[model samples]
Each structure stands twice: as structure tokens, then as C-alpha cells.
Target: MTRLPPVRVARAATTVRTAVQGLTRRMVPPPVGVLELVSGLIEANTVYAVAKLGVADALARGPRAAADVAAELGTNPDATYRLMRAAAGYGLLHQDGDRFDLTALGRPLRSDAPDSMRAVVLMIGDPRYQSVWARLPESVTTGTAQAEAVHGVSMWELLDRDADYAATFNEAMTRLTALDWPTVAAAYDFTPFRRIVDVGGGHGRLLASMLGAAPAAEGVLFEQESLLPAAEELLREAGVLSRCRLVGGSFHDRVPDDGDLYVMRRVVHDLDDEQALALLTTVRRDMPAGATLLLLESIVPPGSGPDFAKTLDLDMLLFAGGRERTEQEYAALLDRAGLGMTRVVPTISTISLVEVRPAA
Candidate 1:
């Protein structure tokens, strides 16, 4: 009824226009972010090509044209180019003239490259893991591990009993351990302790790194009986076997309580609350009066902010029935074990060190 001011009317119109623009933006697709979705699909699909063709391992010989690679591997040249082109588009590899050269990612895909992604290619491309990913939508709806549902037995149990899978599974862990070493060695200091015990130290790569970093420090590598031999060889090569002890036993059964520093890296997250509590409890019982316990893991950040480790959490849910934890979650677990949480050291962007000493 009352006459409106011209300035106010114009301002309101401007506000409405700006709001519509924002709404339009929200509805419109983003350019760079969408690239990741496309890339993820491409990587998952092409993982088969490299894993089956042994392209990653073969690349160590040197880059070759799609024609030559297809000939050596006995595949259609055009098909191989399509596959390689997909990878090249994602910066996994590059096509220089006719030859495909290793990018930063391609280098790691090589078997010779330390902590390479070759095992990743194998594991992700393998049927057991692959089938589960196909059932991801089912998991999303039901909130359960599709792997367990499809395969019947648990992922761990299946890997344990299957001879072929066991070897590949162990090798994959060893490879991941190798990938983690450079960042860990650069960031963590192992000099404070003379005797260090690595629980569930697969292939002893972590222990080797620790011992290498602290030449004066002796190490004990603990794992299942079958894994001990492999650990022994790894430690032997690192020249720490003289000082290293291989304890082929379970942490649930008993831990070697001889060391001042007891460490477990990426081990606890592969368990549910009950098993995690039990494992931590075992460590607590075996820990010396003044021993230091170092839990190497990723301390999940609060909220939905981007986190590399969070993806691994879903992986734990899918394959391992385990989980990634927030810092609060880690504290809760430590509390249950009758241990106190001390300082947590951020190792690399994707990992951290939870330093827990004896609770006074």
C-alpha cells in the first residue's frame, strides 16, 4: 500500500539476481572436480590392463610403442593404445611421439620401484576385491561389507587359507610398507630407543627402516609363523638380523616384552572395536613399566573435509571390517587399553604417529 523507495527496490532486485546466479552455479557441473570422478573410473578399469599385461613391471625395461607392447604381450595394437591413452590422459603415463614414457605415477607402478603400485594393480584388479567394488552400491544401501556377503568367508580368512592369495596379500602389504618408508624415515626419529619391537611387521620392511635410521638400535620383527621367514630375509638384507629378533607369534597370544619401544603401524585399523581393544590390551599387558608405545596411523580429522586416509577407512569397512579413527577415537581405544594418549606426530599427509608412553 505504501510507496516503496526506488533505491530499496533496485537493491532487492540485485539481491534476487545474485541469489539466482548462485543457485545456477550450484546446479551447474564443475570442470576440475568432475575430472576426478572420470579419472577414478578410468584408473579402476585400466588397472586390469597393466596388471594382466605386466606393463608396469615391463616398463622398467623402458618405454615402448603401443604396437611393440601389444606384439610382445599379444594384444590388439589399437586396443592397447586406447587403454594407454586413457592412462596418459590421467597423467599416469605420457605418450612422447610414439613411445609411452613413465610419469611420476607410472614409475611407482613398476615392480622395481620401491613401494610401487604393482601390487595395488594386482589387488584392486583381482576378482575378490574387484567383485566387492561392483557390490559397492549394495554396501552403500545396506551398510555392510559386500566382500563378506559375496565371498562368504571374511577377506582375511580367505587370504589366510588360499595359498595363491596369501602370497599376493603378504606381498601387497610389503609393497605398501615400502611405499610408506620414505616419508616415515624422513619424518620419524627412532634414535631414542635401543631395542624396538615391531608388532605384525610384515616382511620387516618397517623394522629395517627403523634400524637403518638408528644404526645403534636393534629390532625384533613379530608376525605369524609363515611371515617370519620373509621378515628374516628382509631384516638380514638390511644387516640388522644380528641385532633383530624374529618373533613368530600373535599379538593376541603374547607379545615379545623385551623392547623399550613397541610399535605397530597400520595394524590396529584393520580391526573392529572388540579386536582392537583386545590387541591394545595385549600390548598394555606386555609393555614394560616405562616402555613407550608408538601407534603409526592416520588420525582422522573432524568433519567432511578432504582426507586421503578417509578413503582407506571405507576400504577397511569393505575388505577388513576395520575402520579409520579420528583422534578422539584413538584416544578412546587407548583409554580402553588402560593407556594414556600422549603426543601424535603427523608423519606424512596421510599418516600420523600416536605416541603413548606408560600411564603413571
Candidate 2:
């Protein structure tokens, strides 16, 4: 399947939305419905604000007066009461007089929750990304990334220059990996490979999971210098540090040569075709003949019906100058890098395991 550009995807989404609107108009008035749709952007930002304020965390013990919550979070009392009331209206909190309590929907936003969304919310709502998203029209109009247009640099470059933002972004990614790795580990068979290398694997969570799953399989977590400590700590905590090697290097240059299986999760989508091919070429330089490579990512299905990858495609367009690709599109990319697409294994999660090998 040939991947449609972002503009076409947006047009198609609008068409689908229009059809849904027509059906909805049978009951609700069109103006009211459209206004609700328009207000969705504000609602999303409101959630972000509360998430960043750690409102759920503040209310973790019990309900508190809005003034108390505001004092705890170091914000204006009146403003906090207004936010709390709005949040209650949105089902994120429950308001009782001047007090507010966190709802189930809001609990996950707590900083200390096991499945916390605090980092995810913070990273997504980061001013850097928000400013870029504000200029999304530039991406749509110029067919280029909005991050570059707004910040005069790519999102990756911006992160590099801003250490604090980069740390938050990394935390968010780590949280996401934690959410997805269990499904991937359960779905894929990693027993055959003796040595597995995870290229660009940040903090080595997935590699740790893989190593745990395949006990006989020693692993290497290949990433930049800055990420090694966290990766090392994670591997140690997983009790697989002895079996895992932490290598600091850029995939653009080379990957470790000793692995029989190489993996990249959500890595290729960070680069354009040329950059992706270059990274793959570097992998090919080190991968032995017949070694396997797996790309675990969300595979964009054509003619989408409620697929999140379609939304992510626009994010790629705006932030990374890359794209979410269909299966055929991935096969072509693999072919360009002297790798042959062998198969794609669907997991319980939205991601798929795309298997490839060196071309014969």
C-alpha cells in the first residue's frame, strides 16, 4: 500500500468526521455539535494543565478543599477552584462544595502511579512541542516539519539543546515502552537468537524484557552515551545485567557486530526515508549474513477506521519529518537497505513485529 501524504489523510479524516457529524445531526443540532468539537482543543489543554499541576497526586490521600489543593500545588486558590470545577465537569474530578476529589480517569495522571501518565502529559504538553503544534499549519502547507519551522531546528535538535526537555521526553518514552513491552515480549519468539542487539533502545527496558523471556539469549543495549546509566540500572534491576552489554554509539554510524538478532522499536519512524536507509545501511554493515532484524512499530493500515497510527502519522509529519508507513511501504524501505522483509507478526498491542533479514 502506498502511504498517502498528511494532507490527503487529513482530508479523508475530515470526510469521515463529516459523515459522522451528519449522523449525529439527526439528534443534536449541528451548531452545538460543531461547537463541542471546536472546544475539544481547549479541553485537551485543560487536562494537560491539571496533569502538570499534579492535581491527582495532590488528591491521592483524600479529597481536599480547592484552596488547599491550590496551596499544595503552589497556584492561585480562585484559579484552582475554577480548574477543579471544570475538571469535575469533564469527569476527571468530583467537586463537593469547595473540595475536590480525583476520579478514576484522573488517578493515572498521578506522578507516583504505577501506570502513570504524568510524564506523557508533561512531554506532550511541553511548551517546546506546544509552540510547534501551534504552527502545524506550516507543516500542512509546506509539507515540512512544524518543529523546524517554528524552532528553527528539528524536534530532536531542540531536545539536544534543552537538557531538561530531553530528560522529560526520555521519561515519557520510557513510560510508553513499559506500557508496550509486555505485550511484545509475550507475542514474539526470541528463543532462536543467541545474541540480540537492541539498536537505539533507550534505557534498555525492552531489551531487559527480551532477555528475561529468552534466558539463553545474551543481549546488548546499543544507544548514546547519556542513556547508558539508566539502561545499566534497568538491566541490573531486571537481574539481567550480567547477560547484557551496554554499548554507547550512534546507529547512524554502526551497530554492534556480534548480535544474531537486531531490534529497533519506534526508531525508524524518527527519520525520513534517506535517514532511515542510512541507519539501516549502518546496521547492515555490522549484521552478519543471515542475521535477523526486527522493527517493532505501529503499522499504519490503509483506509483507516479509527486507527491511532493515522493520528501518529501527522505527529511524524509535524515533529520528526518521517511517517507511519503501511506494510508494503516498510517492505520497500527494507529492500532499499539491502534487507528483505520476511513477515509481520501482530501483537496484542497496536504495534507489530516486522521481521527482516539480509538480502540473499
Could you tally the backbone clashes for each prediction?
0, 0
Per-residue lDDT over 135-187 for candidate 2, one digit per residue giving the tens place of the 0 to 100 score: 77888898888887777887878877888998899899888988887667766
Top-TM-score structure, candidate number:
2
Note the Cα lDDT for every prediction shown: 0.79, 0.87
Report the C-alpha lDDT of model 1 over 232-270, residue by residue, as the tens digit. 888888788998888888888789988999999898998
Which candidate number has the best lDDT?
2
**Position 202, candidate 2: lDDT:** 93
Can you give the lDDT of residue 5 in candidate 1? 38
Pairs that collide, model 2 = none
